[model samples]
Target: MLNAVEFQAKIQNGLIQIPDEYKQEFGEGDDIKVIVLVQKKSFPKKDIIDELTENPVQVNSVLSREEIYSR
Candidate 1:
Protein backbone atom coordinates (compact mmCIF):
# COMPACT_ATOMS: atom_id res chain seq x y z
CA MET A 1 0.00 0.00 0.00
CA LEU A 2 1.02 3.57 -0.74
CA ASN A 3 0.65 6.45 1.69
CA ALA A 4 0.26 10.14 0.83
CA VAL A 5 1.37 13.07 2.96
CA GLU A 6 0.75 16.70 2.25
CA PHE A 7 2.73 19.58 3.73
CA GLN A 8 3.89 23.01 2.74
CA ALA A 9 7.61 23.73 2.65
CA LYS A 10 10.04 26.30 1.31
CA ILE A 11 13.02 25.48 -0.87
CA GLN A 12 16.44 26.67 0.23
CA ASN A 13 19.84 26.07 -1.36
CA GLY A 14 18.05 23.92 -3.99
CA LEU A 15 16.86 21.49 -1.33
CA ILE A 16 13.47 20.92 0.30
CA GLN A 17 13.42 20.36 4.07
CA ILE A 18 10.84 17.85 5.26
CA PRO A 19 9.06 18.61 8.50
CA ASP A 20 10.13 16.71 11.60
CA GLU A 21 6.62 15.34 12.25
CA TYR A 22 6.66 13.32 9.01
CA LYS A 23 10.31 12.33 9.16
CA GLN A 24 9.72 9.09 11.06
CA GLU A 25 7.76 7.64 8.12
CA PHE A 26 10.96 7.24 6.12
CA GLY A 27 14.31 5.67 6.78
CA GLU A 28 17.72 5.72 5.09
CA GLY A 29 17.89 4.46 1.45
CA ASP A 30 14.16 4.94 0.97
CA ASP A 31 13.01 5.79 -2.57
CA ILE A 32 10.15 8.27 -3.05
CA LYS A 33 8.51 10.25 -5.89
CA VAL A 34 8.58 14.03 -5.76
CA ILE A 35 6.40 16.65 -7.45
CA VAL A 36 7.09 20.38 -7.28
CA LEU A 37 4.53 23.14 -7.72
CA VAL A 38 5.30 26.87 -7.97
CA GLN A 39 2.86 29.74 -7.65
CA LYS A 40 2.98 32.57 -10.18
CA LYS A 41 2.61 36.22 -9.24
CA SER A 42 -0.45 37.83 -10.78
CA PHE A 43 -1.10 41.54 -11.40
CA PRO A 44 -4.50 43.15 -11.12
CA LYS A 45 -6.49 43.27 -14.38
CA LYS A 46 -7.31 46.98 -13.96
CA ASP A 47 -3.68 47.85 -13.34
CA ILE A 48 -2.56 45.94 -16.39
CA ILE A 49 -5.23 47.60 -18.57
CA ASP A 50 -4.28 51.00 -17.21
CA GLU A 51 -0.60 50.44 -17.93
CA LEU A 52 -1.36 49.30 -21.49
CA THR A 53 -3.58 52.33 -22.11
CA GLU A 54 -0.91 54.66 -20.77
CA ASN A 55 1.74 53.20 -23.06
CA PRO A 56 0.41 51.31 -26.06
CA VAL A 57 2.57 48.97 -28.12
CA GLN A 58 3.79 49.97 -31.55
CA VAL A 59 2.63 47.50 -34.21
CA ASN A 60 3.27 47.42 -37.92
CA SER A 61 -0.16 46.02 -38.77
CA VAL A 62 -3.10 47.53 -36.92
CA LEU A 63 -6.44 45.70 -36.85
CA SER A 64 -9.79 47.47 -37.03
CA ARG A 65 -12.34 47.08 -34.22
CA GLU A 66 -14.55 44.96 -36.50
CA GLU A 67 -11.59 42.78 -37.49
CA ILE A 68 -10.74 42.25 -33.85
CA TYR A 69 -14.33 41.38 -32.93
CA SER A 70 -14.65 38.97 -35.85
CA ARG A 71 -12.00 36.67 -34.42
Candidate 2:
Protein backbone atom coordinates (compact mmCIF):
# COMPACT_ATOMS: atom_id res chain seq x y z
CA MET A 1 0.00 0.00 0.00
CA LEU A 2 1.09 3.57 -0.69
CA ASN A 3 0.51 6.61 1.47
CA ALA A 4 0.58 10.29 0.63
CA VAL A 5 1.79 13.21 2.70
CA GLU A 6 1.42 16.88 1.87
CA PHE A 7 3.52 19.72 3.24
CA GLN A 8 4.89 23.08 2.19
CA ALA A 9 8.64 23.65 2.26
CA LYS A 10 11.18 26.14 1.01
CA ILE A 11 14.07 25.15 -1.21
CA GLN A 12 17.50 25.91 0.26
CA ASN A 13 20.81 25.35 -1.54
CA GLY A 14 18.92 23.27 -4.15
CA LEU A 15 17.63 20.92 -1.48
CA ILE A 16 14.15 20.47 -0.03
CA GLN A 17 13.95 19.83 3.68
CA ILE A 18 10.99 17.79 4.85
CA PRO A 19 9.17 18.76 7.99
CA ASP A 20 10.20 17.10 11.27
CA GLU A 21 6.73 15.79 11.92
CA TYR A 22 6.81 13.60 8.78
CA LYS A 23 10.40 12.51 9.19
CA GLN A 24 9.67 9.38 11.17
CA GLU A 25 7.67 7.83 8.30
CA PHE A 26 10.81 7.14 6.26
CA GLY A 27 14.19 5.60 6.78
CA GLU A 28 17.68 6.25 5.44
CA GLY A 29 17.27 4.04 2.32
CA ASP A 30 13.60 4.74 1.63
CA ASP A 31 12.51 5.50 -1.94
CA ILE A 32 9.89 8.24 -2.34
CA LYS A 33 8.40 10.30 -5.16
CA VAL A 34 8.81 14.04 -4.98
CA ILE A 35 6.44 16.51 -6.64
CA VAL A 36 7.21 20.20 -6.64
CA LEU A 37 4.63 22.91 -7.23
CA VAL A 38 5.51 26.58 -7.54
CA GLN A 39 3.00 29.36 -7.07
CA LYS A 40 2.31 31.64 -10.04
CA LYS A 41 3.17 35.29 -9.47
CA SER A 42 0.40 37.86 -9.95
CA PHE A 43 0.87 41.38 -11.36
CA PRO A 44 -1.13 44.38 -10.20
CA LYS A 45 -4.09 45.12 -12.50
CA LYS A 46 -3.40 48.87 -12.45
CA ASP A 47 0.25 48.35 -13.40
CA ILE A 48 -0.68 46.06 -16.27
CA ILE A 49 -3.29 48.55 -17.59
CA ASP A 50 -0.77 51.39 -17.29
CA GLU A 51 1.89 49.45 -19.18
CA LEU A 52 -0.58 48.53 -21.97
CA THR A 53 -1.73 52.16 -22.32
CA GLU A 54 1.86 53.43 -22.30
CA ASN A 55 3.05 50.96 -24.98
CA PRO A 56 0.08 49.65 -26.92
CA VAL A 57 0.39 46.90 -29.48
CA GLN A 58 0.54 47.96 -33.17
CA VAL A 59 -1.39 45.87 -35.70
CA ASN A 60 -1.07 46.09 -39.45
CA SER A 61 -4.69 45.03 -40.07
CA VAL A 62 -6.90 48.09 -40.37
CA LEU A 63 -10.69 47.93 -39.93
CA SER A 64 -12.94 50.89 -40.68
CA ARG A 65 -15.84 51.85 -38.36
CA GLU A 66 -18.39 50.63 -40.95
CA GLU A 67 -16.63 47.29 -41.37
CA ILE A 68 -16.54 46.79 -37.61
CA TYR A 69 -20.22 47.63 -37.23
CA SER A 70 -21.16 45.39 -40.17
CA ARG A 71 -20.12 42.33 -38.13
Candidate 3:
Protein backbone atom coordinates (compact mmCIF):
# COMPACT_ATOMS: atom_id res chain seq x y z
CA MET A 1 0.00 0.00 0.00
CA LEU A 2 1.13 3.56 -0.78
CA ASN A 3 0.85 6.35 1.76
CA ALA A 4 0.66 10.03 0.92
CA VAL A 5 1.28 13.12 3.04
CA GLU A 6 0.86 16.86 2.34
CA PHE A 7 2.34 19.83 4.20
CA GLN A 8 3.51 23.39 3.52
CA ALA A 9 7.23 24.04 3.92
CA LYS A 10 9.66 26.75 2.93
CA ILE A 11 12.84 25.96 1.01
CA GLN A 12 16.14 27.14 2.42
CA ASN A 13 19.53 26.71 0.73
CA GLY A 14 17.73 24.78 -2.05
CA LEU A 15 16.62 22.16 0.49
CA ILE A 16 13.16 21.31 1.77
CA GLN A 17 13.16 19.83 5.26
CA ILE A 18 10.26 17.55 6.00
CA PRO A 19 8.46 18.27 9.23
CA ASP A 20 9.10 16.09 12.30
CA GLU A 21 5.42 15.09 12.45
CA TYR A 22 5.81 12.93 9.32
CA LYS A 23 9.25 11.52 10.09
CA GLN A 24 7.93 8.26 11.55
CA GLU A 25 6.06 7.39 8.34
CA PHE A 26 9.18 6.81 6.25
CA GLY A 27 12.08 4.47 6.80
CA GLU A 28 15.71 5.66 6.68
CA GLY A 29 16.51 4.04 3.30
CA ASP A 30 13.08 4.29 1.66
CA ASP A 31 12.74 5.91 -1.76
CA ILE A 32 10.18 8.70 -2.12
CA LYS A 33 8.88 10.98 -4.87
CA VAL A 34 9.07 14.73 -4.31
CA ILE A 35 7.20 17.59 -5.99
CA VAL A 36 7.93 21.28 -5.53
CA LEU A 37 5.43 24.07 -6.14
CA VAL A 38 6.43 27.70 -5.76
CA GLN A 39 3.79 29.97 -4.26
CA LYS A 40 2.69 33.12 -6.11
CA LYS A 41 2.77 36.60 -4.58
CA SER A 42 -0.60 38.24 -3.84
CA PHE A 43 -1.28 41.85 -4.85
CA PRO A 44 -2.67 44.46 -2.44
CA LYS A 45 -6.20 45.89 -3.03
CA LYS A 46 -4.88 49.42 -3.70
CA ASP A 47 -2.36 48.10 -6.24
CA ILE A 48 -5.07 46.03 -7.95
CA ILE A 49 -7.44 49.06 -8.09
CA ASP A 50 -4.67 51.26 -9.48
CA GLU A 51 -3.91 48.67 -12.14
CA LEU A 52 -7.60 48.22 -13.06
CA THR A 53 -8.58 51.87 -13.25
CA GLU A 54 -6.11 54.38 -14.61
CA ASN A 55 -8.95 56.81 -15.47
CA PRO A 56 -11.87 56.39 -13.05
CA VAL A 57 -15.42 57.39 -14.06
CA GLN A 58 -16.65 60.88 -13.03
CA VAL A 59 -20.27 60.30 -11.99
CA ASN A 60 -21.47 62.88 -9.40
CA SER A 61 -20.62 65.94 -11.58
CA VAL A 62 -22.26 64.44 -14.67
CA LEU A 63 -25.49 63.25 -12.99
CA SER A 64 -27.06 64.47 -9.71
CA ARG A 65 -29.21 62.37 -7.30
CA GLU A 66 -32.40 64.22 -8.44
CA GLU A 67 -31.91 63.19 -12.06
CA ILE A 68 -31.12 59.57 -11.14
CA TYR A 69 -33.91 59.29 -8.51
CA SER A 70 -36.66 60.77 -10.80
CA ARG A 71 -38.97 58.01 -12.12
RMSD in order of candidates: 8.1, 7.3, 7.6
Q: Clashing pairs in model 3?
A: none
The candidate that achieves the highest lDDT relative to the unseen native structure: 2
Instruction: Give the TM-score of each candidate.
Output: 0.57, 0.58, 0.54
Residue by residue across 1-71, what tens digits does model 1's lDDT show?
Answer: 67788888988999899999999997889888788887657854677778899999889998999999999
Assess candidate 1 and give its TM-score to the true structure.
0.57
- Candidate 3 Cα errors over 4 Å, as ranges: 42-71
Q: How far is 35's C-alpha from truth in model 3 (Å)? A: 1.6
In terms of lDDT, model 2 sits at 0.89
Q: Write the per-residue lDDT of candidate 2 for residues 1-22, one digit (tens) a residue.
A: 6889999988899999989999
Q: How far out, in Å, is residue 53 in model 3?
A: 9.0
Pick by TM-score: 1 or 2, better one: 2
As for candidate 2, its clashing pairs are: none
Kindly provide the TM-score of model 2 when superposed on the true structure, using C-alpha atoms.
0.58
Better lDDT candidate (2, 3): 2
The sequence of per-residue lDDT tens digits that candidate 3 reaches over residues 1-71 is 77889999988998888899999998999999887777878764577678559867666566678978995
Tell me the whole-model lDDT of each prediction, alpha carbons only. 0.86, 0.89, 0.83
Instruction: Give one clash count per candidate, in the order shown.
Output: 0, 0, 0
Model 2 regions lying over 4 Å from their true place = 42-71
